[model samples]
Target: MDRKSVVNQILSLLVSAAILAAGTFVFLTLIRKPEQEASANPKPKPPVVRTVPVLEHDGRLDIVVDGIVTPYREIEVAAEVAGKVVYKNEACNGGRFVTKGTLLIRIDPRDYELQAKRLTSQLEQAGANLNELDVEVKNTEELIKLAKDQLDIERKEVNRLAGLIQERIVTDSAMDKAKQAELTSRNSLVRLQNELQLMKTRKTRLRSAKELVATDLELAELSVARTEITAAVDGVVVQDLAEQDSYVQKGSPLFTLEDTSAVEVKCRLRMEELHWLWRQAGSQRSAQAVAADYQIPQTPVTVTYELTGQDGVRYEWQGVLSRYDGLGLDEVTRTVPCRVVVPDPRAVNLVGADAIARPSGAPPALVRGMFVSIQLHIDQPDPLFLVPEPAVQPGKAVWVVRDGVLALVKPLTLIELIERQTEAGDLESHWLVESKTSALTPGDRVVVPPFGVLSAGMAVEEDGTP
Candidate 1:
């Protein structure tokens, strides 16, 4: 209680109080220290990046194109001879089917028949004239023979008279009369010979006229045959402009027929797409190689169309690569036209070759102008890797995930780039990549797009991966 005792006690109490304060501060710091330490040096959360598997398989690329179907053959039948239509076939109307050589229309044959009859009559008359002239020629030759005989007899008599005169047994007047008789017979023979020659010339001219008339008759018969119009091909009548009792002129269009036994699809493809197709179809290893060889081989193709049924099934038909159509790059779309021919759409089966079971409902045939899809196989035996379009980055690089780490890799071989315009008109490009690098292999995961602030060697977590 004294001043010194009080100071020592106060100092002890102060020291004790300071120790207690220090102990309380240590207790509070220990209690709250965990949160601050955790805030300062925290374990990082891996960035969640979307990823897809890298699939390696046989490079059977399926190329799709939109096109319209058309008939393989279309023909326009024209009238070859002018006449009134006397008859028309039942199949001559629009939308009716007709076989080859089926009679479609018949023009009036009376006129052509009369013309042929007239020519035949002329030919008969010419022939008759020739026969009459030949007979006259024969008769005139007989008369000429008689006249020659008479001249010979008269000459002999003149010679006998001359002998008698030499013997002084006959008068000079008798000898002169015999010579005059021989001269008269000789002149009559010359006149008969001239008449026979004229008859022969007439006969020759008549025969020539007969030949000309016969040719005219043949032509008239041909015209009569042409009056019966017939179908030239097995097809469907798309348009029929001829009717019974209708007068038609030569070269007038009678009907338009569409050969529906087969159909053609007219489609367009890009240059790159064409290259892929050439690679599939040609014997060369690459499209460039095929082009260098200057040969475009015909390849197999498949055509499909979605039916109107409720099953959402597609019907397919087999076809072959027909021709390049050579419709060079379009100015508007920069695509080249191609043509495919399905030999017989009616022969197509309802179910596809790869189908496990038969399809339901009746199959529909390929109609003209029906919108269809075409599939062409562009498979290469070599292995190829498919990375989803989302996983592809700029510069033709891809974000590959290895052991949960992101890597940017550039493949060595880029076989092709398929670009398709979406319904919104935006071009979406998908790549077909090939690589010999051991770093990239099948079953590896690739980071998809929108990977927030991703870099090489960055740790990533695949969304939805167990």
Candidate 2:
């Protein structure tokens, strides 16, 4: 072929290659990038905002309290007499029952018996001595009477002899001798009387000594009797130390006595509860408060039981107020002691799980002896300012919307309750103050859905409209 025709073919091939490269570049740069961007990017979801309506009340306050129940008159019996334990009944440790005077234990009585016998012989000897002394006293009294009679006669004789001497009817020596004889006889009689009196006084002292010996014998008998241990009360023996051949010291714990036929629990009520109890007492109402202890009306601790419930909820039985610690205010929760006693759970039938309790406004169930748990209650009032927990933050802080702006603030008063009550003497009366103006004021429309970052005192679109 000719050289010019071959060159024309080459030029046509070059033009075709240029057009293909340019078309490929344009498609890759514009169409693929737009498609990739549209596929990767996505629209985000709206933010969720928790809010609550404002409430108000003539707010009397209430509070929750924690307490427990314990048996009354619990005592651990100790041995009062020291001895070797020899005998005991099966009712020793647990499930032991004995009536008054029931023998609980026995010590080796041989030694005490010997002592008692010896005391008995001594007492018999003392009694004989006392009887002999009584006879001697009677003899002494008779002798004193004789002596007085003899003295009177001798004095008369002496007087006659002196008169004879004065008249010179007899010799002076004879008269003198008669007088002297009378005097001597009188002196002898006086000495006999004194001896008798001394014997009588000695007999009285001997009788008194015998009486003392008798008392000693009685005491010895009593000591011997105490060696046989016996029960003083009728109850179940929760503890037992009396056993075979065990040495026990005086006043050592021997047994625990319990009467389970009736049981009681101890509890405390709030100040409000004490007020109710006092009123009950004043009214001369024999009506037993549900677990009433009349004595200790107020204490921070409470022991209580529910007396009634609805729909298969078992009611707690009523009981008289057995005791009270006294009424007073507590600094921590400001609640008074209210103790409601009922029949022991072991003694009575129980109702349901709903009967379990939590303190006012506390959602968590009660665990006995817990520390730092909330116990406050908002009393019954009209138009309550109830709000969800989420709306309020710690330190009672909440968000407010004003003029389309958000603000954070601490509330002046905030009352929370898991279960609210309106009793006759509750804090909440007819009047109530209700508001949500925490950090914001009225007439401020808040942005329902916040856009971007949220902060205190930040500007927001009114009704989210802009």
Candidate 3:
């Protein structure tokens, strides 16, 4: 009975197996057509990618920076002499512009004038005294001459008396009297000479006193002149500290003046920017400059002030890269501070295509505390390639398409990344890079974004290429 049951099961299993094989054959036949058709065309189309052509940049590169306007010179006007302010000129007020030597204030000069007059009187008295001494000296000289003549006569008399005494022709008393008269005349001549010497000494002292008085008078007059304060430079008054009837001591602050002759712009630049500047200065550097370590060149810069409420309307002033502002990089910004000096702040040029004619009232001069834009014009000594920032992959590499194949270039030297304004007034960031080992030329196509997975030596087609 088991054998018969097993045989029936085996036959049933065989029939089921045959049915499964038939179904499998039918499935294979239906799928083989599509598989064979796909095998017929084995190579799939290459992926399309967006690419940008590298452009050679002009050697000139303009670096833009924000700056502040400052006065070239700020002068603190102070009182040179102490006095009460008797008059204050209208030009002494704040915001008033005054020319050099323009009198701005007047102090009470009466006191100084009185002092001068007193000195003058003393000087005149001294002169009069000197004249009197001169007259006395002359008179004494004349008297001395007369006394000499008298002495000579006395001597002759004495000689005659002596001879008489010796000859016994005259009494001894007459000879004695003659001797006494001769001695008296000699003493009188000596006295006159002594008086003349004393007069000469007095004259010398009087002359010195006269000179001292004259010097005093000069100083007094100088003080009087100093009482009237005047502008030492052509500038605008920034502050007014002196007023009418205000008493001020010497060295007191009277006003503050900002020289309008020129203005300076204070700006900061990154180290990368400074490198370009150094390159520009390298060729033209003098030995003296090198010795002095004058690193920043006197590069020409354009200072622009955008007029408020006026889009694209800017006032431009030509300036030079005068000096470095500080000794080192700024502590917070890590940038070098520099200064640009505009020799003539008033010489402003309107620099917009739609700029209107200069109005009757002149544009505002570059003053202190004005925020401005400074563009440094620098010329690079070497050629550079500019590529869109996105084209530069990680590790300073770029995906360059050569002969319709993707090639990944690595280790490209990135000189700088700069934001430039397009003609449409849109800002676009570009990478200034140089290829040292790779054959990256000016017209080489660099693959950009919006592409599929990329691999080295993979076939790719430029999206815009036919």
Candidate 4:
């Protein structure tokens, strides 16, 4: 094989010329292909950053509060009178119920009965006196008629005497004597008439002594009635003060009754809670706790109670939203006094359990009387906005890439903060949000890490394409 020539010196030069031409043609063709393609379809400039498609997501919150079950109605029984223990029913406590007019305890009836008997005798005496007055009135009526007749006779004699003396038919002395006698007799008749009238009037009325006795008798009977202690209302007898046949003093204690009317809830909403919660959803009367104002199944009320546990299941009792108790004194704490009725404790507990939490995810149970942190929505939608709250300060800035560059757009404020006593974030800790103007802008070339050179105008390559 000759390196430079082939067949002969002339043949070799010709062969070389042909081979060089062929190589040169192939090389030019390959070079022309890239230039032609480059002009036909130009590759785009890379973007400064990559972005994602945003979709609207729901953003409501569920709020949770700490609370406990409480009774809508409860009472403390106190005695109106004092008495020795005598007839105390064995079953008497907070849980017992009784019927109206039921006898709770009996005091000694001997003394009361004797007093009643004495009153009865006195009442009979009063009746006898009344009868005697009736007889006296009848006799006085007859006497009145007699006195009228005598007065008429005396007037006739005086008239006759006056006429005779004026006509000079009778002596002066005789006329004067007749006049004096008539006047004396007329005066006596008038006195008798007054006496008869007085008797008639007195007969219609009972004597003061008789009236006094009658009142005493009635009182005695009333005292006797009190001896048999009876339940005033339909309730449970919670306290028993006297035993059967026990001696008791007037106005002494005998027994106590508890009105177990119906079940209700007593919720103790703190003063601060009223402003934050829907306490006005139900009225005091419509609320379950108000006994007279509401019915058990039909009515509802705000009730409250205390939670006496730290980490255990707490028991709930009922209470009411009673009137505020501020008597001529300053309050150390400004919490408003609120009462909740515990009409149906089970229902109340269920509602309370749900009403407390405004959680974005699985939340812990709210304990009663404990303070909770909350995030509240303050402002509404606006034309201009900044970065969303949670992603703003912690993460790097995100922007839309354009023409191999970055276009920074306005951001949305995502989270609304309610600064409470137990809130997680502090005002001073939010330095990034405050100094956002100096750090970012509307259009700037940005570099997103983890994805190399995701430049503007770069093809949106199929994800996971190697």
After superposition on all C-alphas, the RMSD of every candidate to the true structure, in Å, is 7.9, 14.1, 6.5, 13.2
Of the two candidates 1 and 4, the one with more favorable TM-score, higher being better, is: 1
lDDT of 2 by residue, 66-161 (tens): 445444444587765677887876656566567767777776666667777887887788788778777776776777687678767777877887
Highest lDDT: give the candidate number: 3
lDDT of each: 0.80, 0.55, 0.87, 0.47
- List, in order, the clash count of every candidate structure: 0, 35, 0, 67
Q: After superposition, how far is residue 358 of candidate 2 from its true place, in Å?
A: 28
Q: How far off is residue 244 in model 3, in Å? A: 1.3
TM-score of each: 0.68, 0.54, 0.74, 0.50
TM-score of model 3 relative to the true fold? 0.74
- Cα lDDT of model 1 by residue, 15-98, tens digit: 999999999999999988998998899688998987767766454776778889988988988999999999999989999989
Provide the lDDT at 14 for model 3.
100
What lDDT tens digits, residue by residue, belong to model 3 across residues 1-466?
6899999999999999999999999999989988898889878899989898888877567778999998899999898889899899999999999999998999999999999999999999999999888888899999999999999999999899888888899999998888899899999999999999998888888899899999999999999999988898899999999889999999999999999999999999899888878777786677675724655778899999876667767888999998998689988989999999999998888877666887544367888898988988887766778888998888888898999998988878777678867778899889877544455887889988867779999998888731
Top candidate (TM-score): 3
Model 4 lDDT per residue over 1-466, tens place: 6855555888878999999999999999999999899899967853323332221222322122333432323344333333444565554444466777776665555666787798789778878977987888777777768777876887788789888888899898887787787777777778777877787677556677677877887876776666556666666565665555565666665556655443322223343344323323333235455443221212123332223332322223333334333322226544433333333333323123433533233222222233222211111121222232332322344444444344443442332232222134433211112122333433322333335543334543322211
lDDT ranking from best to worst?
3, 1, 2, 4
